[model samples]
Target: MSLLKKYCLLGAALWIACAAPAFSEYTALSTLLAETASKLEWNPLLESGVLVKDTTQVVFTVNVPWVIVNGSRRINVDAVRRQHGALVFPESTAKEIRAVLEQTDIPPKVFRVAAIVIDPGHGGKDSGASYVHTINGKSIRVSEKDIVLNLAKKLHVTLKARYPDKVILLTRENDTYIALEDRPYIANTIPVKPDDAIVYISLHANASMSSAAKGFEVWYLTPNYRRDLVTTASVGKEYSEIVTIMNDMKEEEFTRESVLLAGEIASQLESAIGAVTENRKIKEGEWLVVRKAKMPAVLVEVGFVSNLEEATRLMDDAYLQKIEKAIYNGVSHFIEQFEQSKGFTE
Candidate 1:
């Protein structure tokens, strides 16, 4: 018999033997497990009190609230435990599981993705922020523009290799200047099918005078763009007004989805660069690429080049590979979650 069926039978027998109040309806975590997981096993001796297999197996250990989801450690509000010969946890735990199920659930409809746009910030004459380090009596200069361009190229290559069928475009393929307003315009010009999805990622490296400021972060457009922005166009009055109205609507329309994607990327960044620093954060910011792009867009500060230690690490080829992989994983995760949430079957 299935776990849920057995539990129902047991509950019926117990109801006949004792007062109904003895058993609370809310404690049916096993029913939730049976409904959600393709397979579940309860073994007290096992390190995790309960084992669930959902595409991949995840273990929830007793007393330890964290659960391993597809090899990533995610915080769970409550720990898994065995009670009265049954695997159980707090009601909040069930709610958490429900949330995960909702995120991963397959949707009835799918939005076809047309293209993925990659923007590397500050190119050509704009060398962007730089940090100088002396090594063996030789001066080494690390420029944010160069590092971001390199990283964007690596990401482009990786994304192309992984999603061969998808259209992936880079704003500037080399060290050439592309106006901030024009970057998103390039993506906007791409022809796509109706309701097709598009994603924009702006690659950047932050700098600070404090030198102590270092860590990865992601930024999405906030909802209140019109109130926060100041119009600066004087010559192209008509064009400026049209752009402003479009940007304002885009920001308000995609805030929730952009924040969701940002959260996923930020969460994975913490795992990828945890050794470097655990101070990763996500915030709302207005940047041309993020604000002007009429799609789910985000700006990622891979690392701070201003900090001496981070500059050295960011300059490393192998570390750059890790950052690229982290970004790929985060983006892939968001795509999957978004597809499932939207009920996209394709």
Candidate 2:
């Protein structure tokens, strides 16, 4: 062969040898790329081969045909299937990738609770009223103060048991006179952070001029004149204004929420006690106790002390237990609704 021909033949041989391995490497890379693409459910037509979209700041490479979740110091992806057909990811990598998924379109889980305060009405010198009833040929007198205190105690126990994690507090534990002004003050003064939630309920029994009329009723604070009836009688006009001002502040803070909370508790109590007693239905009232509480506050009149039958039941421990259960159910229902509305599952 001529020198030029020989040289050309040598060059051709070298080129073929180099091209063979290059073709093999390309074929292997193509297979890996296809597998990764199939696993990621990405469109094969849109992307192919190694793509470095950016290289200036943080490098984003599409070399392996897999999506990478970038973390502070590393990148992560779901592990490829193994010989045993097991699909898994490194714990750390899975966490990082999950975080990215959550940030992209999924919401993180959260939890919240509804705090509550319980107040049993009338203590110490305030013995409230009493009623005499003849049952089983025996006369029994049920004192309003004692009956209400026992009911409050039962309510606290029931609520605490039902919602162990939730915060529940009582204004007075024993027969002590907690000044009406100081009741709301204690509620408002609870050391709560900015994000804390709270609700309050004051318990009492109703009295009426007609002893014939009797049933259970719930009260939420309203600006009606009737609310003033209680405060006016309790405190003189001069002190009433101060009380009114203080109550206004509390109402402003909890007006909207108080209505909702009262409705919830009332519904539960009516359901529980109404089965045994006459259905009183939930009523709106401007009772002083409900009006003055700082947080979402309500006053629950379990039954009428004026009624002979209800006054008798009020003394029964078993009947009080039923009322306690109702109060617990109401509080639980309220908390559930509030948490759900806020998107807090826990």
Candidate 3:
């Protein structure tokens, strides 16, 4: 039988045996546990007692209308009194206490990565790192915009197939130019609960004046670059100092997650194709994309377009597939770790 039902069956204990003037129905501490099975610990000298059942605990004192519940919530009830060296409370107070134990005091919050945003860098008028090279009398051209878009689409498809329950989105699905500032806006605008988190990953290809610089590099925002992430609407303008501190704390949380994500992707890249070229390793930067994003964010430079050897490899469909696979594995691993760790509190 349920605790509430059993307690209700013991209504005889709440019967008023004799009342001179007051019609109050009180139950004695000794009779409280009679014909019922919930545990009660009472201290007569201290005039205090505690009732415990399942996950609920109720603490009360003699001659007090207020009762401390679960050591946190203080609830008001009819005053408990010491009658003939025994503690007891009126019927109304008993009902109120019973109601408290049946409800409220839910479990702690849990964290989850519910949404992911993939931003393919540069498109349309702003063809990022445009390079024209001729290899063995054959004209070849490589655009960073096109390469990253292909990779982003592949990654999106793979992730969507893997996690159909989660939300996966792209800043620009077609070959359209998206402003740098607008990219992060897509990620920030995603509505999520306080315990829920979002991930923002921007894909790009690197370029240099010298053709020698070639490798895949993952970038995360530097910890030193503080973002102005506080919103005044949540709190009053007079609490600006407190708001700044709170914002700083929130910024640190996203930064930590971004670093973890960057590390995972960098390690996966090395594992994917370490023998072919450089992993370049995860670097710290004040990138606008990462800075503006209000969630965990990272930027990946898949390879260099300026280098003939790297550019030739980048043009290959199979090569881009390898890079895409590496990124997918990295993101998958990070999401697993993040969810399992419950936002990495320890």
Candidate 4:
């Protein structure tokens, strides 16, 4: 079979994400091929792909900002990348190639993560769990609201820098009041196009009556919660009758995604999971991940504040930085894979 024929056959079987509207800065490889009638010969394992258009040829590498034209000329543009493990291209670079092998235009379709919402639990009038400790005769107080807010800000800053195209938000930017319901509401209200996803992460420091409690825990919503996720606005008025079924499907998707996300965060925290607490595990901690948010949401109980030793760790800027790195990296890794597959779990 011809290269084009083979790719066409594999496109459906492989669930290729190489399609995006021309309006987006990034163009999927499939759209580019349709526009230019090009043949793609690329190996995903090698993280590189090539496009053939009559006498013209283009070579692209994942995360590379430049493309090799005809194996001689170097053209710089946005890097060729895997759209959720599927091949895609930057519009700027694809346009140059398109000009060479002009063909009919077709609208491109794509799925991407449009936004991320970070919520810091307990703010303003809510002091949350307050504890005082004396280290070497110096008394210090730990405030749950303050610790989480600071950590949230750090995570927010890092994520915002990494995803300039995404909407990064914090429910409480400062030590201000925000209702529990309002936080997830902020996440759900974020305007997004079809096939676009938004994830919610609520940060909090756990407290227990037993001062010995320590270590970190990540939580996800169980399947029991039924939320009104599908509506005429989401599935269109024509499909409104099946909204209930769609909502169930959405709940399953969100549940699976939440589990995966929580696992990632838990895995990343292993490095710092220490002697203070035994057997750090994933748990159903707070209801923040529950009925409130209409998306894949997780609540991270970042160690137990009730324990003086652990409280000290949460309060420590250096220790908090470690948590920040772990959480940030965890979220980033999940986002990369999620967006790569366009949030397809199965």
Residue 133 in model 1: lDDT: 82
**How many residue pairs in model 2 have overlapping backbones?**
0
Instruction: Put the candidates in lDDT order, highest first.
Output: 3, 4, 1, 2
Candidate 4, TM-score vs. the true structure?
A: 0.66
The digit string of per-residue lDDT tens for model 2 on 1-346 reads 4222343354344324323322211222223323333112111222211111111011112223133221112243433221222122333433443344334343332324546788888888886766777866898766677887897888788778877877778888899887787777677667764435677888888777788777777777663322332254444443332334323322433555566667777777777777767666666666666666655677888888888878877878998888888777777776777666532211
Off by over 4 Å in 3: 1-106, 135-137, 235-241
Q: Which stretches of candidate 4 lie over 4 Å from their true place?
A: 1-109, 232-237, 274-279
RMSD of each: 16.4, 23.3, 13.7, 14.0
Question: What lDDT tens digits, residue by residue, belong to model 4 across residues 204-282?
Answer: 8888989887778888886657788887685456444334544554677788788888989988888655454553677
The window of 10 residues in a row where model 3 has the poorest summed lDDT is 11-20
Residue 279 in candidate 3 has what lDDT?
Answer: 81
The reply for model 2, stretches above 4 Å from the true place, is 1-114, 223-253, 343-346
Model 2, CA-based lDDT: 0.56
Q: Model 1, which residues run further than 4 Å from truth?
A: 1-109, 226-253, 343-346
Residue 276 displacement in candidate 3 (angstroms): 0.9
**lDDT of every predicted structure (CA atoms):** 0.68, 0.56, 0.77, 0.74
Residue 130 of model 4, lDDT score: 82
